[model samples]
Target chain A: MTTPPLAETILSFLKKINPHQPLPTAEQNLFELALLSSSDFITLIQLLEEESGILLDFTQIDPAALASMQGLLAAFSAAETGSKL
Target chain B: MDHYPWLSPPDHTAQALRMDHHLWHYGQLMTHAELLSRAIDWSIAGPLRLLAILGNQDPWVYPAMLAAHRLGGGFLPLHPAFPSERLQHMLHQCQTRLLLVTSDGLATLDQLLPNLSDSMLCIITEDTKGNRPLLFPQHRFLDSTDLQQLPARPAHPAPNTQAAYVMFTSGSTGRAKGVAVSFANLHAYVRYWQTHHPIGPGDRVAQPADITFDLSIHPIFVSWASGALLCPIPPATRFAPARFILEQQLTVWVSVPSVAMMMERLNILRPALFPTIRLSLFCGEPLPTRTAEAWRQSTPQGRLLNLYGPTEATVAISAFEWQAESAQQEPPGNVPIGWTFPEQQAALLQEDGSLLLSAGTGDLCLAGSQVTGGYLADPDKSAAHYFYHPDSGATLWYRTGDWVQRREDGCLLFLNRVDQQIKRHGYRIELHEIEHVLRARVGHDWVAVIPWPGGTQPVRALVACVAAEENSPTADWLQHCRQHLPSYMVPSRIMVVPQLPLNHNGKINRAALQQLVQATLFPTEAT
Candidate 1:
């Protein structure tokens, strides 16, 4: 699947926080992101929630989006489009 | 009738007491209590106004316990081996009018007497006929002859919130914090434990922890509250754990991981030795997976429970039941402290002042009735850690410096301390994640990931390991890690150390390890 525009923005924000991780693929899940202990996840979530005005619940959000770099970007795109899916 | 009602109440007679032998027998205990009641009455009325219980070895402390309870005087329990200063501080703090000691502890107490106030009385447990300045009357274990002469006193209710005992806690701050646990809290704890772990009349609880440590309160008071047998082990014999448990037929083990590890290392527990143990309780420090695995292999009949709490919160605030099947699969990185007991709540909060409720990870905080009011003397430090939740109203939550994540499954997994979070260059780092990842790869099951101060560069990861040289290849370990972790997360240098310095409780002494690293970096030059 093509990287979603929302995913691109989220990935950019995450990369800004963690220079070591330059690019993120949508397949990366919550466990992987947590393993990296990246600074961007929380900051990006807040930024997206503020921009979209839809207060995202990171705690209950789909584990797949936070699973890998690819998955996180995809989730960000979905959030931007106003669908939790 | 005994003169002191609260001190020597008739209701505290042999009928109310319960003692059990491991072989499911009970005659000797009843007979002994009857005899000891009289002996304590006689001794107290006669020359022996004071008594000292060595506490560690004397299997039957019931009579001594009753004797102190009946006499309307306080029972001052001390670790027979405590350094003079610590012991003196405790004795002074407790305002102990009299001190009871066994023959063995006499020498230690005697050496400390000059430093002690002259008003104190010293009573020995074993018979020593002497008119020496420090010498006093000795009392024997309960025998049939003693019970006959004891006068029965009227019963009165025990004050629930009165100071039952003062136990010293080692605080991160320099001064030791004395947790003055109330009788009400003790009673509540005992009632709570008794309800959970049903103890009938004949059950034997192995009291292994030193009296100085609060965990020992479980075996001491729980036995009394539930009418179970309290079996004390010799302090020295604690080193030889296997023999002690086997001979004592210890039904419950209440101790820290350090003592438990000693038993595991010494091969003290075999399949045959522990059929009676219903519960093996571990607390005070973290239990390494290796030690937990060893215990599981030895005891299949009993349940192993890990209890976690600061002394500030009475003995244990949270507990996790260790299952052999589940543990073998995940093999705990840092065992989650489970959840708060009955009425307690555990929460996490983010740096932005938002509460990270429901599976969110941040600074782990505890709120409940079990949370103590504050530190004994220091209000500034106390105010910093304890805060009231205006949203919750009236109730306060203690800001435990521990950082943790509430897992999706609702288990609270402990991360490192909040202070452990350090920024290397612009990157925030948690050293524990690196340590956990390193152990997952290497043959060295033991590893500590520490950041070395690097001038004008990102802090260097100084990895210390105890990997075996014969079979495990270092390249394979690095390659295995490369597949899972990013290059930045990996340690800059992985060095093999002969042994890691461990604290008294067997945890890798992080402060000492950092000091060792600093020493290596700046070695002393000989003149």
Candidate 2:
């Protein structure tokens, strides 16, 4: 089985959480738009972990890295790569 | 009345509070309070009027509160995270001309200066460094360093009848209502706590709620009056409250039940995590039985109490002690809101102006020292909720608007709010205000905002059902709501329906709307 792209998975999750709002692009800042709060960010991490089977080190992850779609993709990709090793 | 009861003797050496790396002794806290009081007296003229304190939890909050009382003024604490518009509304509502803020709060005020009235003056506690020029040119800013340099003067005695603090809660009409509590009310609360759950000098009380919240008043005043050390939990530690309790070695823990729910969600609520906690009090929102059980398991040695009261009734007016033997007897997943304090009286009244004596449910009416006279500068709104007791001639009772059932044991079980208000994440929100904003945005009066898991289930999210014109876009309506309301007030989901279902009474049937929302969200369950 092939893994889906990190951005695709995240966008799918975002769409699931907010079905009414317009789909956010990868470059859009999720935090500034009030689409996600700190607790929501924590939920996002949990969802990502469940989907990818990669346990994230919550203490090591910077909250700023999850503020934007592009940032979240990068953080997830890095975590997935670290888990594979 | 020469000095407050919290102040230690001049020669005594004991820690009064611990924040981060800072530890303030009781003697030192008194001297600092005196210094701040003298500075305020010299800088401001006449009676202190309304003083606003805006910042995060810090040792300065105690001194600022003490100084405001000493100057015969009411202190209003503003949440630094609140939008500038909400802050401005509160500042104007209470007519706060004097502000005591930290450096961060100064930055927030700087952004809101244009919206603020010109009569406001700010006395900041931290040095601005080179950020002095960032402040509004018309307003004066003084630092704590300057306050320390000023000559000390004798503190003035504040009358017990004077207002102590003003806290703003969400109003159903889309405006924040300021509830001004007097010093006498606070004294009554303090006396009640002293008689029931007394805290001594050795107790280390945990401050979990933000300063802007009424729940925070419990730890602040209770600790001060008892000379107990106050341990403020940082924002990060709140996510893992049980761990924070263990690390801080807190003896008395007071917080909203939502914190316990969060602990349960994180799976961190294990038995014996809080062996040192002697008292665990939960209030603000209804305490779920599961959350209470988890908390009790963690702090088996501590006495668990579920307190219930609105902001209008001071911090809390009634308390129900949770016990393991009576756990099965409580409502499925809720703790009972027990007897009222000695200084307060509670009565349940039905819709037809009849009292619910024994084993009947009705709207809860509270009258006592804790209940506020009314909202500040809003006599109409105050009169709407407050009325003369039918039997007790001339006694004013504030209708809680909360439906509660009186059990055979005399304990009250919270049914639900009589109005459209709901508690989500421990913050009180008015469903009508959301519907009102949506109706205005959608250009239609037929809109119903319902909380999913509707009746009795803790509200997780708001779902707005609107009857819009054919092909009317919901995204635009959501954008408009986002612009006007706070993030918490915004509906999580928007369902555009052709028409809202109404019951035989010609009212928007909330039960139908709630079912529609649930069915739409979970199509599988509906079938």
**Top lDDT: which candidate number?**
2
Candidate 1 lDDT by residue in tens digits, B198-310: 66455667776455566776776676566566676544334335545655566777766655554443344445356667788877656666666667566677788877776
**Per-model TM-score on C-alpha atoms:** 0.57, 0.86
Which candidate comes out best when scored by DockQ?
A: 2
DockQ of 2: 0.20
Model 1 spans > 4 angstroms off: A1-85, B1-56, B59-76, B96-98, B123-129, B132-155, B172-174, B266-273, B328-331, B349-357, B377-387, B418-527
Give the per-residue lDDT of model 2 (tens digit) for B1-527: 34653353323477787887889887777777777665563334323266788887567877778777766666889877677878888887776567788755766777777777655667778854246446466677677777877887666666877788888888878787888888888888888998899888888998886788788888888887887888887754554455456667899998878777755654567788778998999987888888888888888888999998898888999999987765676656788889889979888888789766678899999999888888888999999888886678877799998999888888888988888889876677888778777888777788888886776766666888888666678778878887667676788778878889999999998888888888887454321
Q: Retained native contacts per candidate, as fractions? A: 0.00, 0.10
Look at candidate 2 and tell me the lDDT of residue B415. 86
How high a TM-score does candidate 1 get?
Answer: 0.57
True lDDT of residue B233, candidate 1: 58
